[model samples]
Target: MYEYIHGKVIEYNYQINMKKTFQFSLCGQCYNVLVKLNSKAKKKKTTRSPSPSISIAASEDRINKNEMSSEEDNKSEFVLAYKLFVKTADGISLPAKWFQESISTVDKFLLSVYNKIHLMTKDNTIMPSYYFMIFKTQKETGASTQLVDEQDFIKFKSEYTKLAARKSNIGIYVTILQPSITS
Candidate 1:
């Protein structure tokens, strides 16, 4: 998965999409550990598919964040971006050398499922902007929960909360924070 994201980072870099970003192979052995997690989720049937509206909204939000399209007063002062492109247009690919076979299996499953995920949070706007391109996965409850990059979402949450602190009405603002994916 990391390798795939690394490829995305490269693409964005080459396309001049992301200007301030860096890539590194952190904890090569950890990829296997993460992949193993996917198998466990599969066995437990913990996969979910996000609503189509949510998927589109998330992708658009990512584009906006990357472009910093919000008004200065409406934008969050803190934002982070991550890349996740695994395959080349011509089918060339890189092997993920982080985990063992078990983990590799999980990584493969997630790579097949999760595809690309981008997260963003903005403030001072009418609603808080949250978006993701979640993959389909079954949830432990025999229900599908859109599989998403928990880490990237976490970063968005942290930054969003900080921006939210300045708002007067949390509940009212919270409602605005959610993306109108359906529209």
Candidate 2:
């Protein structure tokens, strides 16, 4: 099962060697709800048309790896990011541009989340509560970014949120606790 985490602004769970880390809490209610939602999404996906990989694989088989190995290399560029899964009246969907880690300030981060909610609803009427789930993600393809000029660096301000097909690998970063002490 996928674990969901929430971001904290005030303090971290532990500190060592001048670095601080905040541990995410596992809420039973949230975990169960997400699991059910995930299962429904999986069911929907299975009922859809065949995946794009089928055609891509067929094309790849015809070409020699040595000659045309990089037909879609640019599509695989990666950026470390966070995935914000928001639940609203509409459904479960991600907020725009919330995946970028460069949202270093708390105010902007909150604003972006609210902005996405507003855009999704398109109504001035405020919702009573907001449900948020954050996972450390790697790409911001769904994020809307401003068009960059020809002269500017590609990753300027780390707002490259339009890249597609981000693969989230948060499990790779999790580690065990309860360190053993040497006498």
Candidate 3:
């Protein structure tokens, strides 16, 4: 016997010592109904037309062509942008701003950030190289990574993408690197 549950067919059978018969009683009534355990439905065998097989070299060529086309499409379609929240070491939050991938290098990004800070504080004595930025992950125990001018913005963009995927607030912490005194 078979039963349907949630649009799926399941076998229904209960046996005790290889015996299939079971007793059932209803309130003030006794009735008997016959059920066929074996169904008369038959499944039809499907026949499909034979398909021509391609040579291994032909298949490999097709795959390589597809991969090349996809690579070109990705290069043309790729656009990287960021909405950065800047905060100081003293916990003061600066206005958030948008940056495009066209900024290219971390040095350029730091310069732009320095310009923003300069506009607010009106301090021109400090250079962009004096301040370095740290990106902290979205988790409470997440480690902070420092961004350096030698690296490209793609690294920062990738880190941002990872945190953004978690749907949490992301910000960059900026701190001044004090000059070390020597004897």
Every model's TM-score: 0.16, 0.25, 0.40
Query: Which is the leading candidate under TM-score?
Result: 3
What is residue 45's positional error in candidate 2, in angstroms? 69
Cα lDDT tens digits for candidate 2, 29-122: 4455456546755775677646756744643354334224432332333443544344444443334333444443334444655565456545
* Predicted structure 2: lDDT: 0.38
Q: List the residue pairs that clash in candidate 3.
A: none
Question: How are the candidates ranked when ordered by TM-score, highest leading?
Answer: 3, 2, 1
User: Positional deviation of 108 in candidate 1, in angstroms?
Assistant: 46
Residue-level lDDT of model 1, residues 101-157, one tens digit each, is 111232343443232211122122222124223311111133222334444334334
* Better by lDDT, candidate 3 or 2: 3
Give per-residue CA lDDT, model 3, range 105-139, as digits (tens): 45566676677656644456656565677766434
Identify the superior model by lDDT, candidate 1 or candidate 2: 2
Stretches of candidate 1 off by over 4 Å are 1-4, 13-47, 50-53, 56-183
Backbone clash count for every predicted candidate, in the order shown: 20, 1, 0
lDDT of each: 0.34, 0.38, 0.49
